[model samples]
Target: MPELRITTLIDAPLRTVAAALLDARLLARAVRGLGVRISGGPVLFAGATLDGSVGPVDGTLFVTRADTTGVSAELVGGPLPRFTLVTDLLHTGGGTMVVDSVEWSSPGGPFGRLADVLVGRGLALKVLEARAAAVSARSVELLSARVVVGAAIIRDGLLLAQQRSYPPEAAGKWELPGGRVEPGETDHAAVIRECSEELGVTVEPDDQIGPDIPLRADLVLRVFAAHLTEGEPEAVEHRAVRWLTAADLDTVDWLPADRVLLPALHPLLT
Candidate 1:
């Protein structure tokens, strides 16, 4: 068996780096010679599989583990069998540190071992390097882009939604309580501040709900799961406020961006 490891430092937050690494499309682009397709859950989630082929050689990369810290996967039917890959992301002083490790066994006996040393190592190294570069570029893009935060405050199996009252075209549409992330403010802090200003309440933000959605060329929308900590909510800046059950999601005319998140929001209500 032979093992190879590569480490890279990305000038981006850990969250941004993790998001890029977990992206199926980005991973597919990183792979060479193979046309990969996602079959089951997300690429990073356990039990997910990436089915593809390298020329005539069929390959299936199975995700074995995934978490905030790292991910582990194995390729069983490719040109390299019993090929294992593990990636770890750590928060460093300057940015995020990504460590990738790969292990594989040669197929034949002496001849196979010789080929692996001469050719296989180079191929594997190139693949890992390409993947690292892809992640780095994606993370930089996310880091430089502006972000809008939306808070999904759920209580008693009901989600809070607000109606807009300004900007004629969007006046009657519904949306979550949130706004732009101010300079030097974290997403969680922005969520707390926005909810307080618009809804007149204090909220504790939790994990993100869904993917980061593009709002404009320079802005992206991210929704977070939240809970009330103090004060009852009132529509201070909007036309109205309502607590809705999962089944009631489609009843309102949500703003396009918020509407895109309905499927991910439903699970929080239950």
Candidate 2:
């Protein structure tokens, strides 16, 4: 069997580069303009699959093993007769470098051998390039943007809180009554809409608390202080809802990001 190898260096920290390589969605985005299709397993490990097509030919590749030291993959099915493709990822002092190699034996006889000589190197390089692009795109996406909104409904000296009951992302955690902002709506409008939908209470547009606070990942979070006008807040989207005093903020498990708002909220509400 003959082998084809290709290597490239990426200018990012090892951990950052590793994470992008491990994420399937990030990998897909990096190779966006390419006509190739790609998919992978839940985690970077043996038995995980990466299936895709280049031009007219389709193929499925599998990760045989991966660890802190390195990672490897094998090509299962493709236009070629028989082949195993392996990729190794390593951390260098300056950045991470990825090297991909392919080993294969001819299917029939001299004709297969000649075809391997013509196509193997080209195929291996195409796969390596696609993988590299995917990793880079994922890194950029994760670092790009994030946005969150929190609601503070204060009556007397108490703040309103809700316990979410949905997916792990939203369930079992106590948070202020707001969500992501939608397109074409003002922050104030989004807050009012969220309060009405989540708590079943109508808030005047003027009741918004203050300007949005910027967070990591280009995220902007807006916290609003509004009054409950018509009815008591019910748990429509959450498992529970309660009015809490400034002292009660410490008792519940608030989201880590929202916890940053507590100290400032304490003095203003109390």
Q: What is the C-alpha lDDT of each candidate?
A: 0.76, 0.63
* Candidate 1 lDDT, 1-270, residue by residue in tens: 788889999998776776666665666677655333334323345555777543233568787755456668887676655667788999999889999887777678875576476435476676678789988998877777799999999999999999999999899899999999999999999999999999889999999876565454356778999999999999899999999999899777887667656767777788
Strongest candidate by lDDT: 1
Q: Candidate 2, residues 1-270: lDDT per residue as tens digits?
A: 777787767676554454455444444555455555667543443445788654344688676644333456555687656567565667788667867666766667776766575556465566567776665555455443354557788888898899989787758888788877787777677877898899898765344343233343345456777776777788888899988887788777876445535655777666
* Error at 228, model 2, angstroms: 41
TM-score of each: 0.58, 0.44
lDDT of prediction 1: 0.76
